[model samples]
Target: MDELSDADLERYARHVILDEIGEEGQIALLEAKVCVVGAGGLGSPVLLYLAAAGVGTIGLVDFDRVDRTNLQRQIAHTDAAAGTPKAESAAARARAINPAIRIEPHDVKLTPETVERVLTPYDLVVDGTDNFTIRLLLNDACYLMKKPLVSASVVRFEGQLSTYRAFEEGPCYRCLFDAEPTEGLVPRCDTAGILGPVAGVMGTLQATEVLKQITGLGSGMVGKLMLFDALDYSMQIIRTRKNPDCPLCGATPAITRVGG
Candidate 1:
């Protein structure tokens, strides 16, 4: 592991002072690689904080280009980047935050075939994607790769966060939602509208979970879901358990590959 640079020491002064995340923990963060599966609302703060915290390598996957409406929540992209690709915009911001960090931008959607190929190299995966299809795919890919996944979702004023390490015996995302919700059941941000700061709160929490896992500071939400109600400013914690019949991690498994 490389020692902290003087600049890093000063930039992360507060983190370095904390016994939970001293120079040693910071070094561990410098050697860690994390993949973020979106560059939109939930991804904005997650990418920013993780990069500032000195995660050694970050992979950003997104194929969308920036739009005028994205400014409300996608903090990484600016007016100048309104027409730029989301991943490129996010990667630029991440690089600006911490040049020492290596950011690999995948300017494409993560299909089942490409999921494992993109995710296998990372130490951990952060699911900031909005749709259930991408979320389930990421969960299954992480399970197959035996990697830890920090998943978070935000819609309107409410959001959910969970961490899954199925390879370590915790429940996969499939255990939480047996099957994908029916179409139109949950409105997306574009259709339902979202409070920008609400996404910030959830994304920041997701980044916190990632850092906690990286530094081993506190116990992660490995088998629990954190529900945040921005309107009431209340948080609820629900415990989760592995399902023996879970198609992905069960005794009689069906999912054998990234998309299977």
Candidate 2:
């Protein structure tokens, strides 16, 4: 908990003026450490907003390169960055947005072998990855590390967001999804033809949940799920409870390690 400096006060004037996020909240934001996985659709807004909010440190993890197709929704990258690594591109944009913050780019794919080493340093983890395997890996690792994870996904016209703090009383991602779906069971946004703005909506909501968790200004999405249907322009939040049968966070927890 550090005090806000003159530059911080000026840079975050609007946030400082808000009753929910006054000087102290701004200070909290400045001291927070967050890791965002993926630099594609959902991660674009997550990184930008978190940087503009003055979060002191951010870890960016992505191994892919930016392509022309990514430009439609990955706002953090431009034509100039095409063919560049996504993590590096996102880090550059974040630095350009707020020079005061520190952005660490991990240009490597996250694996069961590497998950803990990559994610344990951060206080919070935001999951914007498109794969179910990575999502499950993050959930287990975050639960084991006692780090909060804000996860969101968008495919076609549908999106979902939730926060998992399984070290507490709430359900982990595995509680909602006991195991990874079979290969090809879930369609990728690229193949399914996702609307660009749908990813933005989910990513922005993911950033909002991150800020709320950091500032402690309001109730978070823990133990709840937010579902969005972009086609119908409707949203709904449903309660999700810890499952006693969940292997990761249940009474008889069996997921003792990242890969186990």
Candidate 3:
């Protein structure tokens, strides 16, 4: 465990003052490692807060480059960084916020061969991507890796978030979402158009869940799904259960291993 330096004490004084997250929790944040799989809207707040909270090492993975259109919600990237890789851009902002911690930029595509390697080093995984293939891939990979996955997605006026740790007999993502949505069945955020802060709301909550996962503080959201309707300003927590017949974490499992 890393001890808090005089500077760390001063820097995180607000956090250190909290009875729940005193010096011990500050150290836990400083010693923790997290990987955020997207650098888009949701990933923006997740990465930035984790950095500001002093997560020891933050890894960002994205193959896309920043675009001017992304400026509306991808808050991590600046206009000058429009053409740079999203992961690198996001990492730059995180490092700027807290140079005390390490930020790794994985500017690579997610392949079956690379998913495990990409996720292996981190203590937790945050999914902010909208692609169904990558989402399912991450769900399966995280379960196989026995790592906790904090995932969030925003589309139009609503978004949802969840934390999964199936290896501990908790509900895996697959338990609730057994199959990927059929292609074209669900519209992309680009076409469907998201309300900007909806991403921020969910991502901020995701970051909170990440902190909770690390420090063992507050209610852990392992077996619950949070749904927020930005249009009506309503929020609900729905209980989740592990499925006995789900392919991934079921009694008779079909996905014994991850990847092809």
Candidate 4:
């Protein structure tokens, strides 16, 4: 266990004051290694809070560049950072928030051949990505590695979040999404058009789950999916179960390797 420095105690006074997250939890947060695999809308709050809360090491994976249009909800990037790689921009912001923490920015696209190498160093992975291919690839890799994955997705005025840990008692992503959706069928935030605040709401919730996992504070959303609708401010949680026939995490698994 890492002892909190005087600066750390001062920086995380609020966390230390909470019974749920006292000095012990604060130290755990400072010793955790987390990777947020996207630097766009959902990644904003996830990165910011993880850094602010003293997560010791954070890895950022992104391939896109920050555009001026992303400022509406991609709060991590500033007007001056336009055209910079999303991972780089987000890393700068996180460093600004907490220079004590280490930030590793991987400004590269995630491919099957490279996913394992890039993600293996982290304790947990956050699926802030909006791409189906990467999401499926990550689910397979993480399940095989037996690492916890905190995932969230948002489009239009609604969003959904769930934590997948097939190694544990929860279902893997493949249990619900057995296969990737056909291209052009599922819309992304760019095409479907999302309400700006929707990202903030979902991303914050996503960050909360990440903290919970790090501290083991409360029950996680392992077999549960949370649905948030901004239209009427309604939220619903749907319970899910592991699929014994899930191809990725099933009894007779087919995927033998990260990219197989």
Candidate 5:
């Protein structure tokens, strides 16, 4: 078990007060390692809240630079950071929020060649990337590597969050969508225009799910999918099941390796 310092006790006073996440839980958080795949909108709140909660080590992977448009939803970056790499900017914000934690910045795109190498070090992975190619790759990689994956996506006013323990008889992302959609088939936020707060809400919920998974605080979204409709102010939880034909986690897996 990790020991909390006098300063740690004070800094996480609220968490320590909760009976569910007492000193031991706080210590677990301090010893946990999490990797966040994107530093954009969804990654922003996930990174910030996890850092504030004192997650011991965080890995950020993003190759894009902070753009002017990112300011609206990517709260971790600012106007001055417009030209900076998203991973670097998000890392700076995480460090600022909790200087005690270690932030590893991988200022590179998530590719088939680097997928396993990038995700192997962490205990958990949060999928915040916006594209289908990387999303598919992450799902397969996590299933193969046996890492828990917290995945969520936001478009316009709709967002979905789900946790996968596919390695342990639970459903994986591939169970929901077997194959990546053709390019340009789905419009991105950059083209469709997403409400900033919707992404924030999903990302924040993603952070909560991460904390829950790490500390074993409560029932997680292992076999469920949460849907948030910000436009209608409604939410729904849908149960998911593993597909025997799932290419990644099925009875006879076809994809035995990344990019296979």
Candidate 6:
């Protein structure tokens, strides 16, 4: 285990002063490994906060490249970074925020093969991907690997956050949304247009859950889903339970592997 240097102590003074996140929590953060599945709007803030909190190792996965349209909410990528891989650009921004972090970038789409290989190394997984295919794949992968999965989604003015740790008796993502939404029914940020700050809110919540999980300082979102409606500025918590018939985590156990 690496000890905090004098510079680190000064930098995280406020964090160290907090009762919930003192020196011990900071050290736990420094030793924790987290994997983020996308580098778009949600992934942007999640990566930024986790890096600032001194997470020792962070894995970034995104196949998309920075585009002019992404500047609206994807704060990590700048105009100059246009055409650069999103994962690489995100890593660069994260490094700029805190040089002590070690960022691993995978400039490739999350597929069955890559999900297992990339996610297996991390202690926790954060889902910031837009598509359902990748989301389901991640849910299954995290379940099989017994890794904590902190997930968040934002669209238009609404957002949702949840934590899934199948091994710990909490419900997995599949228990809530058994399958993907019908195609063309749910619009992507590129298609429907998302409010910038709304993404930041949900993403930051995801990072909070991740930090809480790592330090065991606060109650995690596990077994419940938090919903945010930006327009109304209201929040609701819905209790969730693991589906005994869930194909992935259920007794029948259809899913055996990360991508199976």
Candidate 5's residue-wise lDDT over 143-237, tens digit each?
A: 88888999999999999999999998679898888766888888789999899999999999999999999999989999999999997889999
lDDT of each: 0.91, 0.93, 0.91, 0.93, 0.92, 0.91
Residue 79 lDDT in candidate 4? 94
lDDT of 4 by residue, 1-260 (tens): 65788988899999999999999999889889998999989999999999999999999999999998778999999999999899999999999999999999999889988898999899999999998889999899998898899999999999999999888778999899876678889989889988998999999999999999999988989999999999999999999998899888889988878988
Provide the global lDDT of candidate 5 against the true structure: 0.92
Which scores better on lDDT, 1 or 5? 5
Candidate 1's clash total is 0
TM-score for candidate 6, residues paired by index = 0.97
Clash-forming residue pairs, model 3: none
Q: Evaluate residue 101 in candidate 6 and report its C-alpha lDDT on the 0 to 100 scale.
A: 80
lDDT of 2 by residue, 88-107 (tens): 99999999999999999999
| Poorest stretch of ten by lDDT in candidate 3 | 251-260
Report the lDDT of model 5 for residue 166: 93
Ranked by lDDT, the better of candidates 3 and 5 is 5
User: What does the lDDT come to for candidate 6?
Assistant: 0.91
Off by over 4 Å in 1: none
Give the per-residue lDDT digits (tens) of candidate 3, residues 99-161.
Answer: 999999999888788999999999889998989889888999998888899999899999999
Off by over 4 Å in 3: none
The residue pairs in collision within model 1 are none
